[model samples]
Target: MNILLSGWQALVDYLTIARVISLIIAFFLSGAISTFMSKGAVMKYFGPNAKKYISYAIASVSGAILAVCSCSVLPMFASIRKKGAGIGPAVTFLFAGPAINVLAIIFTFKLIGTEIGFARVTSAIVLSIIIGLVMSILYQKGEEIDPNENMFNIQEENERTWWQNLIFFIILLAILISGVKHPILTIVFFVTLVVVLFLYFKKQELLNWCSETWILAKKIVPLFIVGVFIAGVLTAIIPETFMVKFVGNNTIGSNLIAGVFGAFMYFATLTEVPIVNSFMELGMNKGPVLALLLAGPSLSLPNMIVISKVMGIKKTLTYICLVVLLSGVVGLIMGNLVFY
Candidate 1:
């Protein structure tokens, strides 16, 4: 009984810390992306008729910094697409946005080993470019739009200087680094940053920003809590030995299966880390570990429902399948080379 209680307590502590860190990272990075990187700039560089491969590279790299979850990325993706980004590049952004984000990568490294971490990053970048190229080929000659129509006209804010923005960015970075080392300190550091930023900015402006951030947090936090609870329950109920039966060794079949499962299973934003850690403790192999890391966050249940509404069922399903298959193949190949 004592041991069980201790385990439950540990789970709660970990979840609380992880959630705080994820929120801090998400809030600051999302704000920075909105402030510094204009949609117009993205369109100018990767607009229609841009070299297909170069556009793909740019889209992947840009998405890495935003580090938003799958759901949060949808609106931005839609806005960019509506504005006239080529189908290929737009899709690349969609894929890379969640897959290669800084927070996701950091969480991956922390939860899993560094080997899987690098694999996840490399696979995401390669898969993003491949997905873009294939999407481009499929949509080529289907539709085209004028670049000017697609340009984003973001209102510039003169209230905050570039130096102030830089300070916010630095504070965010420090919070992330500190959170990785000391979980509870993360909460303190993040709160400090938020308070400092608020004091520094005008009251009305700060209130507006806080309102927006809170709205996003409210939307996501409940879902996040539910996900953590589910994971904890699964950890408690499922026997590690049973899970080990399926993924004890880094077998090709196990890796592929894990990848496919990850692609299909709905992992809420930032939820994959805890769930993956649970699986690892259950004796899942490194190969399957990599597979899950690569595929989980990119596709989730809520995310699919939202995407289906936007792109319609057919295209959404097609996109989901392609991501799964590609992720599985990539994991299979990597597992064979690295683990075998």
Candidate 2:
């Protein structure tokens, strides 16, 4: 009964109106962006033959537009990888597609300290690129491919006018950026987006966006709720002393533990932020918190399975190892240098 109540309470607390609205809008915004970007655009920017800096840049920031969790992003990642993206950029996208999502970043900044939030995001982006580069360099013989063959001929290329695109993106951005601040402002942006969708966008486009949004919501929201409930239950069961004794210090072992644990546990969207926050309150050190944040969303057991199927076991194992190692190093450095 106590565990049931704990889980129920967590579900109730997290399933608020504001959170629901934010989730819906964020998923819709991501859907719209992905539709606009298309397979061809992803190939152009993230293909193997693309300039290294440009590809990595795109990969490192792809999550801002994707808004998927580690496991959820695997299909998209595999699609691009099979479509001809270099192992490096594709791996970067795999990490960034979940790590740098807007909801996660905002929630971290809001629920945690400002500096820690910034560090989490920065370290995630840098480490994602590093992992990608290392994987491409190490697995070049098999992973290297021609970008031209990967490029698809998009029939809807440049279909929307520049102004239409600008307005669409601006409205989505406004809604997302303001969702964290004022409720009224977010509503206003949402209303404006709806109006633009009806007036400017084709009926088919609107329907497609809605379908994609629903797909994303169905895939994410359920797991996210379960994860939240489990996190709450774990917090209740685990003694504070245990957390402090094991992860209270900013040591190499502690950071590695956090990273390894996070790599194995699945986190959906912003779920990791709150779970890690609970761990922090239980006496987990700031550095280990960052380590968890860095690895948690980008790598999980389910995520690993999907990636292995796509990239082969050897490549997937190498990527996971790299992510864990780099995450630990970043957390250790941050712990010692920044906050201590």
Q: Considering every candidate listed, which one attains the maximal lDDT?
A: 2
TM-score (all chains, Cα) for each model = 0.76, 0.85
**Residues 1-340 of candidate 2: C-alpha lDDT, one tens digit per residue:** 7877877777788678777676777777777775665555554676556688898988898887555566667888887777787888889899887888766786687667798989988888888888988988898777557657436444455667778888988988788668756879878887888788777778887788788778876776777677778767877888999999989999999999999998998777778876887788789999999988998888888888888998899998898898888888889999999966
Model 2: residue 221 alpha-carbon error in angstroms: 1.5
Over 212-282, each residue of candidate 1 has an lDDT whose tens digit, in order, gives 56665566666655655566666777788877888767666777678677877877765776677777777
Q: How does model 2 fare in lDDT?
A: 0.80
The count of residue-pair clashes in candidate 1 stands at 1
The best candidate in terms of TM-score: 2
Worst 10 residues of 2 by lDDT: 149-158
lDDT value, residue 155 of candidate 2: 41
Q: What is each predicted model's overall lDDT from 0 to 1?
A: 0.70, 0.80
